[model samples]
Target: MAIVTPLKTAAEQTLVQQFAEAKGELPGGPAVRKLREDAFAGFEAKGLPHRRLESWRYTDLRSLLREARPLADGAKETEAVTARLASLSLTGLRLVLIDGVFAPELSALDAIPEGVTVHSLADALVQPRDDLGRILSGPSVGADDAGLALNTALMRDGVFVEIAEGTELSQPIVIIALASAESERAVFSRSVVLAGKGAKGTVVEVSEAAGSAAQQVNGAIVFETGDESEIQHVRLLTRQQAASVEVQSLLVTVGASAKFDSFALVCNAGTVRQQHFVRFAGEHSEIGLRGVNLINKAQHSDVTLIVDHAVPHGTSRELYKTIAGGEATGVFQGKVVVRPHAQKTDGGMKSNALLLNEGATMFNKPELEIFADDVVCGHGATVAQIDGDQLFYLMARGLPRVQAEALVLQAFAGEAAEFIADEAVRELVMGEVEGWLHAREAAAEVSTV
Candidate 1:
């Protein structure tokens, strides 16, 4: 018999040890225990996904992550966190999580309205629900996905939200995740959102971190849009830094006649990856996924999506834009699947990138798989620099070269930013865009001087 040795990276070794040391203290009962064991076993088998996997070719975790930071001390509240949270200045129903643990002291937990039910993941783990397991490991997601599996095994705490049937919320639920300053810890968190039948609501997923030290954060959100319900979601990444790694995933299931809209903005210098898996379980559902990535100065950001149209009369649209400057790299990948029974399914995907400098990079892959002849599906991707003619046209109007470039980039990113329904949230994203534009302008001036 021949024995084979498995090659493992230092991060993988540390992760295996972390699982072993903390498995007993982690939340969830027997069921969750088994799930965690299985998930970790699977993750151990695969290790971290490498460039060999086409799905992860653009952003290879093995090479990108040389080692693992300490498992996050979820209980340790980072100092200056209050000041950091104050910067966003968010109001109206906020659920705050620090280092992946839900913090009632810092959140609007008491002010939640009557129509929605809010609970903590730790509380749920005390008596896990059968549905909670299903929500955590949905069919749309593969059990062996490294990032997700790690999150499943190690997730400490987060929020669970349930909107009652036919109850529309007056205030948008705001979720703020904060990373403590100078903590070299890896944080994993998970949340579930259920929009009951005929219910309507919006959830804002926001985050802030102290980039003084390197930190890794992995989080997941699962959404179930009930029949005829509507859901609006947006994810905003705060701060651009050179020393952070973020992997966030979203899984959504749209019920019959339900509408789902999601937007994500990536304007940070941190190495980040965002993934989405959306499924249409019922007929006549509509879903839209849009995002913008603004990265510069050697940052690497990736966005990947999979939209599965399993039934008939479903519609999905996706638009993603990227702005890469300096040595920054941006990636976008989208795949739409229309099953045989999914007749009358309509799916369209478009991705565009604007490279602002010679060293910038953008990678895009859009795919459509249609088994039903009655379905309409198409995909497109584009990459280009700012047009000289457009720059000239703007400069002719008394605008400086830097200002002209900002206008063009804003318009490029606006195609997706405009889809945000909440005016305040939309304005927040636009404001970030403006700040990024100003930063670029300042850098240009400094270089010339």
Candidate 2:
């Protein structure tokens, strides 16, 4: 008999080496170390996710990531961060994380209003907390995924927000995550947002590259809502590094009679995979998930989501829009699952993509798994180019071809953008959309010239 050992990729080997070297320095207690070891073992067994996995059919990390960069060290107040801070439009309460580490100097920690508590994960890990383990181990959805397992293993520092019961916030809590280009590194950050019973508020997560240097960012956010709570979450990925590789995950558990809404905007990136795993843990809950993706050049962007209806009387709505140009590739994969005992589940999902050039490609996979006969679930997907008639109508009005195309694209993306719960947030997202369009227009002019 011949014995053969499977060879590991450079990235996988580098990850293993990093974990072995940094496990002691990571946060958490004895239990957390054990958790980290277990997670790393899982990742070692499976290696990087590839096209062989059903969930990662479109985005192959093994092939895309040939080598892993060094892990990010602690961040300091630098010129890049200062410039980013100067350019940002201040709104609401802001928390800053530079290179995956919480920055107190850059964050408005003192301005946090009453009834809201903020704790840095690095600081919190030094103390003992009962629910810390549960927060670290996300919900059942995608818990076993290799990428998420890696996140759990080498997770560094993030923000933990807790809303007091029955507290209603007047403004949204903003979490700004910046990747500085001082050096090429890989960053792993995990954050949690807990909404107590009857609490109401909004959270906005903004991710941006402070400079042009490409960085690898593996980030996750967990949202747990108590019964009858209302929480709105918006994730914005704007001005990302052109050669960056970003894998962002969202895990949510909605309680009984709770209202949860989440929206994402992906305007620019090199390679990004934004995935959501949402479970309705209690009955009579409702959720809305929406996103818009704008990609050009050779960039690749993927949005994958799974909504699990594990209880009765759960409602979910998901809509996503993608605009692909140049030779970019876009993917949207949304699945809604109605368990056997989850009767009275109402779920609807739609994915629409627009290709701007002949070489551009879009992949849409909308699915529904209905184990309960009494549930109402439906899904639809469409991939098409811009309508010639609409373009002609705009061109007939003396609009340039590029401008007419931009109008059509904006209107197509607006349908999904309107679902953002907050008006100010919606307008902010649309402004990013317009910025994307303007960049496209400039590129068009350059190409023509």
Candidate 3:
């Protein structure tokens, strides 16, 4: 019998050539370069994640990504880009990245918040700290993932933040990763956050587009929480171009007696995947993960996560809400793992989706892998259309059909958004939801007209 090798996809071939050409120019010392080489080797072996892989069955990158765009160059903060960045500003310590390159002029680095230290990843890599490799390597949960491997191999620049022990930040830290429509290219960035023991703070990451050009952004953020610390993270993925592709991952390791809470809002994205890989590294920790996905008009959105209970007395709660209208598609894949010695673990997960029309689609896959008998774990999922009774009740009360539907959808998605610990952040998320609903209503009116 003769053995034959599979043909490489165009994207894979382009990525290989890019790596070989840019290997020497990428930041980092020998150790970091070796790490990148190893990561690219892994990707070269696996190729792009396809439907054959159980984890990537729903959103197949191999099929979706026809060809690879050239690597993003150093983008100039043009007048238009500056105006766009200004509009997305929030009241906090803001760090901005344009085309995956750190923009110091736009970032609020001159203030130097009291107990917090920030550095550009590119600078850190060139200097090469001992722990930098470990941080960039990421946790075991997603270390072997193909997308993550590619990110590690090509990651150019991102923000690195450290909070001093026992320090409480006065305001949230906002990091914005914005794409430049002037360049049709790919951007890969990796960011890290280290919360010292007993410290408390909130971090918000906003991934938005500068204009209506198609681009690719593959980014990852790693978070490590110390014992007795509390950290709140909010990720808002919005206003993506219709033909753009975005893959973002959150990798976290929670410490003993610490509290970690995260929320993600996905709206108006083209092809997007928001994944989370979390591990309870210490005992007696608690985590809450929640998200809402609003997609319509041929958009594709996916939220996949894995929560690992590697220690005893860990607790996790997850809930996700999705609204798919027009010809959009939404997917939620969640799994919770309880190690054999992870006794006294408590976990609960639920996914609820509302389809606004016959053309919309939703996929929910919830699973649990428990090796411990002394644990409490359960999962549930529900998918349905708007409740006719509720809609009728609103309409009979003098509200128009569009307004009634919007109200109903708002209430349905509010349960997940209300979990944000910060009042202002929660409201900001709701505002995005309202904006999406308004757009939906306008589109409906146009269709009827």
Ranking by lDDT: 3, 2, 1
Runs of candidate 2 exceeding 4 Å displacement: 1-4
Score candidate 1 by TM-score against the native.
0.97
Q: CA lDDT of 19 in candidate 2?
A: 96
Worst 10 residues of 3 by lDDT: 73-82
Clashing residue pairs in candidate 3 are none
The per-residue C-alpha lDDT of model 3 at residue 112 equals 65
83-142 in candidate 2: lDDT tens per residue? 988787748889999999998888998899999999987777666778877777767877
lDDT of each: 0.86, 0.90, 0.91
Q: Provide the lowest-lDDT 10-residue window in model 2.
A: 121-130
Tell me how candidate 2 scores on lDDT.
0.90
TM-score of each: 0.97, 0.98, 0.98
Please give, for residues 115-183, the per-residue lDDT of candidate 3 as tens digits.
Answer: 999998888888748887877876688877899899999999999899999989878899988887665
Candidate 3 local lDDT, residue 71: 93
Model 1 per-residue lDDT at 330? 93
lDDT of 1 at 58: 92
